[model samples]
Target: MRILVTGGAGFIGSALVRRLIAHTDHEVLVYDKLTYAGVLSSLEPVASSNRYSFVQADVCDAEAVAKALREFKPDVVAHLAAESHVDRSIDGPGEFIQTNMVGTFVMLNQALGYWRGLDEAAKARFRFHHISTDEVFGSLGEEGFFTETTPYDPRSPYSASKAGSDHLVRAWGHTYGLPVLVTNCSNNYGPYHFPEKLIPLIIIRALNGEPLPVYGDGSNVRDWLFVDDHARALQAVFETGTPGETYNVGGNAERKNIEVVTAICSILDRLRPKAEGKYADQITYVTDRPGHDHRYAIDASKIRADLGWTPSVTFEEGIERTVVWYLENQAWWQAILDARYATQRLGVA
Candidate 1:
């Protein structure tokens, strides 16, 4: 199959594109806006393949997206482009609303137009897979997990915009008979992750001998999904998932924010230990972001039962590999830090 992956240069998107190009016989055309988070280096592994191609364009640009759709004539449109950072969203929400909400509306409409022009067989086979976060379900108490039937209670602008996009995708499917599949996933962390996120930030700051900032006593919990695992689950859904249905993908590994930081520290201690003290010693508490969700856990039973998909790595194994990837690929992340982000704090209220 020929696949057109939006935001394919970003972390998870690139991981998906790389997986498709490396493991399958599919042709992939990566459509990306080259946003600050969309690093071309992330796609370096598969960029040389003839089956892999890239187009620099924003999902919000209907004209450009339509042209790509018409030219690529992809069997699947995997939409992953958006302003994804919660802290960044808290700092400036307009971009998130414009890209996550309005951009999705544009993509859905353009995809509808493209699908309408296709033949019966083509239309029947085409799929639009919208990738989303579990944060749309808002904070969970202690016990329950977020299922596909869970009500959306987005608290941050980031999650709210994503919630809006998810609604637009389902609405397009329900109202227009478009083939759409939505997946709400837990937090993703692994190779080529943008440095601003928790795991990478902790790794980078700890390596620099700088203070590792933890928000609000660092008790906030999140389900951690490896990016490679997420890429596989995405492929599974687009390939075999039922249209107009939602799948919740998770790693089943829940860790407190402090636990996540300290785990990174422990891995660094083994892989690249400092001379005197441990990396965990640098952890410092800071004010939390506004509207911060307390916990987010995904009940991935549906995906496992329906799609026969499950995460391949535990958080312990995933984090160790992630730290090793960063250590060995210093040039990859260093270039990003030197160019775009300076490893500073953001989203302060």
Candidate 2:
């Protein structure tokens, strides 16, 4: 299969590209905009492979998307491009709406046009898989988990835009008979993660001997999924999942925000201890971001039962590996800090 992965230079997308190049015979073409979150170095491992190729372009450009589809002639169009930071969304939502909502519309329209031109057999084999977040279900109380049947109650600009895109994908499938697959996944963390997210932010700040900010007492809960595990789930879904179906992928590991931060501290303490005090000592509570969700957990039973997909690593094990990666690959992250972001707070609105 020739797979065209949008946002393949970003963290999770790059992980998927690497997996495809290293494990499968599928050729890959990466279409990305080189956004602040998109790091070309993330694809370094598989860039040398003859099966891997890249294009620096925005998903919002209809002509570019159409051209990629016409040229690459992919069997699967895995759509992962979007503005994905919650805090950044709170700060500026227009980008999210444009990229997540309008960009999806562009992708669908181009894909639909391209699909129409294909022969019957090629049309039958093609698929448009939209990758999404469980945040579309909004916040959960304490007990229940989000299932495929859960109603969307997106609270943040980021989630609202994603929810809109999910709807667009389903509409394209239901109304036009487009072969589409949707997957809503839990939180993803692991190697090559941008420094702005919680785990990596805590790790970098802790290493810099700076305060690690925790929002609103740090009790918000999230289900953690390893990036590689997510990449595998994606492959399984596109390869075998039925069109017009939605799968919820999760690591099944839940932890409080404070717990996540402290877990990173514990791993750092064991791997790279501070001279005098522990990394946890730097943790400081700050004002929570507006519309912060209390909890998000996924009922991954459907994906596990239907696709035989499960996370490969526990939260503890994944975090340890993540910490070790940051420790050993200072140059990778240092280049990011030097070039683009400096681990500052965002989404103050």
Candidate 3:
């Protein structure tokens, strides 16, 4: 099958593209805007392969998207393009609204038009899979988990925009009979993740012996999913998932913010310890994010039962592997840190 995947240079997207190119017989065309977090190096493994291609265009550009659709004539359109950083969204919301909301609107319309032009059998096999986040379900209480049926209660600008996009995808499927599948996933950590996110940021800062900043006592909790697991879940859904259905993908690995940071510190202590004191000595508490949700936990039973998919790695194993990857592959991330973003944060001053 021929697949068109947007945001295929970002962490999870690149993982998916590599899996498709290496493991499956599908031809993949990556449509990515190549923002600060989106690095070409992430897709380097599959770039030399005949099955993978890339487009340097924005999802909001109707002309570019429409042209790509017509030329690629994809059997599956995997939508993963968006303004993904929550803190960045807090700093500058206009871009998130434009990309996550309006961008999705444009992509949906273009995909619908392309789907209508396909022949009968080809049209029946076509799929539009929208990748989303569990953050759109807002903060969780002490118990209970977010399921596919969870209501939208986004607190931050990023989550709100993603929620809007998810609604639009469902509306297009219900209103126009478009064959669409939406999956809302938890936090993903793995190789090629941008330094802006918590896991990578801590690892890089720890390596440099810089102060490791923790937010507001760092008790905020989130379910952690490995990026590779998410990519596999996406492929499973794109291939066999029923149209107009929603799935929740999670690692079932929930950890508090402080625990996540501390765990990284422990891993670095073993792998790349400081000369003098322990890595945890560098920990510092900072102000919390504005409008930050308290917690997010995912109920992945639906996908597990239906798709027969579960997280393949324990958070400990995944984090250790990720740390080793960063330790050994300094060149890949250094280029991104030096050229694209200087490791200074934008959303926080």
Best by lDDT: 2
- Sort by lDDT, best first: 2, 1, 3
Q: Which stretches of candidate 3 lie over 4 Å from their true place?
A: 341-349
Off by over 4 Å in 2: 341-349
**lDDT by candidate, in order shown:** 0.94, 0.95, 0.93
Clashing pairs in 1: none
Per residue, candidate 2 scores C-alpha lDDT tens digits across 1-349 of: 9999999999899999999999999999999999888999999999799999999999999999999999999999999999999999999899999999999999999999999999999999999999999999999999999999999999999999999999999999999999999999999999999999999999999999999999998989999999999999999999999999999998899999999999999888888889999999999999998989999999999999999998989998899999999999999999998776344444321
lDDT at 255, model 2: 97
Q: Summarize candidate 1's per-residue lDDT along 1-349 as a digit string, tens digits.
A: 9999999999999999999988999999999999889899898899799999999999999999999999999999999999999999998999999999999999999999999999999999999999999999999988899999999999999999999999999999999999999999999999999999999999999999999999998999999999999999999999999999999999999999999998999889988989999999999999988878999999999999999999999899899999999999999989988775444445322
Model 1 segments beyond 4 Å from truth?
341-349
lDDT of 3: 0.93
Query: What TM-score should be assigned to candidate 1?
Result: 0.97
Give the range of the ten consecutive residues with the poorest summed lDDT in model 2.
340-349
TM-score for candidate 3: 0.97
> Per-residue alpha-carbon lDDT of model 3 for 258-347, expressed as tens digits?
999999999998988788999899899999899878888999998889989999999999999999999999999788777754445554
